[model samples]
Target: MSFNFYKWLQEQDDIIKKGVLFICDSLFVDCNFKGYYIEDNNLIGNVLAPQYETLKQYKELNPYTNTEHIRYFFELTKAGIKHVATVLSYERSKDTMQVCLEEQYEYITIENGVVEMTNFEPLTVLIKEKFKL
Candidate 1:
């Protein structure tokens, strides 16, 4: 199947949120305060670690911001952030995603992809909105 960045992000977010809830429930049942944060580390190591590495690999392959993979990853991250915010009951903000996109664009060379420099700004804004960031 084609790489669906937004879908991947949503799936990741769902997994993380469910994991968090499970951890929270476990803590509550066990009355273990110290263990409250324990699951987070495990989750990060087991789940996020691999995904992070995959993103890094994509970055390495592209080596520039404008590649299709880079853009896909960027959009995915924004979706992830939005999912996190929604789960946490916080209003989603696109500021962080925008900053990241801008930074990515800076390192992008003409060989990366067909996207234009001027297009980056608006794309960031659109991604944020698309993800409810």
Candidate 2:
């Protein structure tokens, strides 16, 4: 079955919507994405990581202007952020990278949506460090 991002997004709770947007904005700025678009039921984009020679060089040249994107993700769970989000890349298909939140006061359920495009090495590092992944 084909996925419908807009339909799925509208069905989600407010916090999940916010988190998805947060991730998109973070990737656009941090990873130097050309732009975002929906394709085959997935949000798709390309990152500029391949243009750089080395991860260190990428890190040196691009310092995070704002830590709130990364910071807010870490606080999502604590602050009662609910739902599940998966951050994936073309290169790391085997790795299931997730930042989980909550749903229902009695118990929490994690849901998956979105697909990370390209190999955002530097941005991945920042997210890993922030989320302690």
Candidate 3:
């Protein structure tokens, strides 16, 4: 069967749609998703074009959103960004995977906030390009 955003979005519950929007909005307001595919029981692989935004925008968009049930949608969005969403969503200062402080990493957290990336350098060119660094 063919896929469409409007049609697929319609199939999701309200919370899922909201979750999708919230995640996308944080990434940037102008995300262009080409399509969605599947892996195991979860949805995977949507060709997306996300415009770069300032760290202030990222901070403003991402609060400590207590998304317990709707986490799957966030996970889907995170996957789209190759898990940069996970780094962005790390609120705790003590997380094991959290390599450094927000102060150390401009735009990596809310405080040192700017569009320029001085922290959490990705290993690959694609991930760097994804974040628009």
- Compared with the true structure, all predictions reach lDDT values of 0.28, 0.30, 0.29
Q: Residue-wise lDDT of candidate 1 within 1-133, one digit each (tens)?
A: 1134323433443333343334334323211111111112212245231233244344344343332221122213321242211111111221122222323222222222222333233333433444444
Tell me how many clashing residue pairs each candidate has: 0, 1, 0
| The best candidate in terms of lDDT | 2
Clashing pairs in 2: 82-102
For model 3, residues 1-88, the per-residue Cα lDDT tens digits are 1123223323432423343344445545333332222111232456242322222332244333332111121222234443322222
Off by over 4 Å in 1: 1-3, 29-133
**Models sorted by lDDT, best on top:** 2, 3, 1
Write the residue-wise lDDT of candidate 2 on 83-118 in tens digits: 222321211222333332222111122325433332
Worst 10 residues of 1 by lDDT: 30-39
Candidate 3 clashes between residue pairs 3 or more apart in a chain or in different chains:
none
In Å, residue 4's CA in model 2 sits off its true spot by: 5.9
Model 1 compared with the native: what TM-score? 0.20
TM-score: the better of candidates 2 and 3? 2
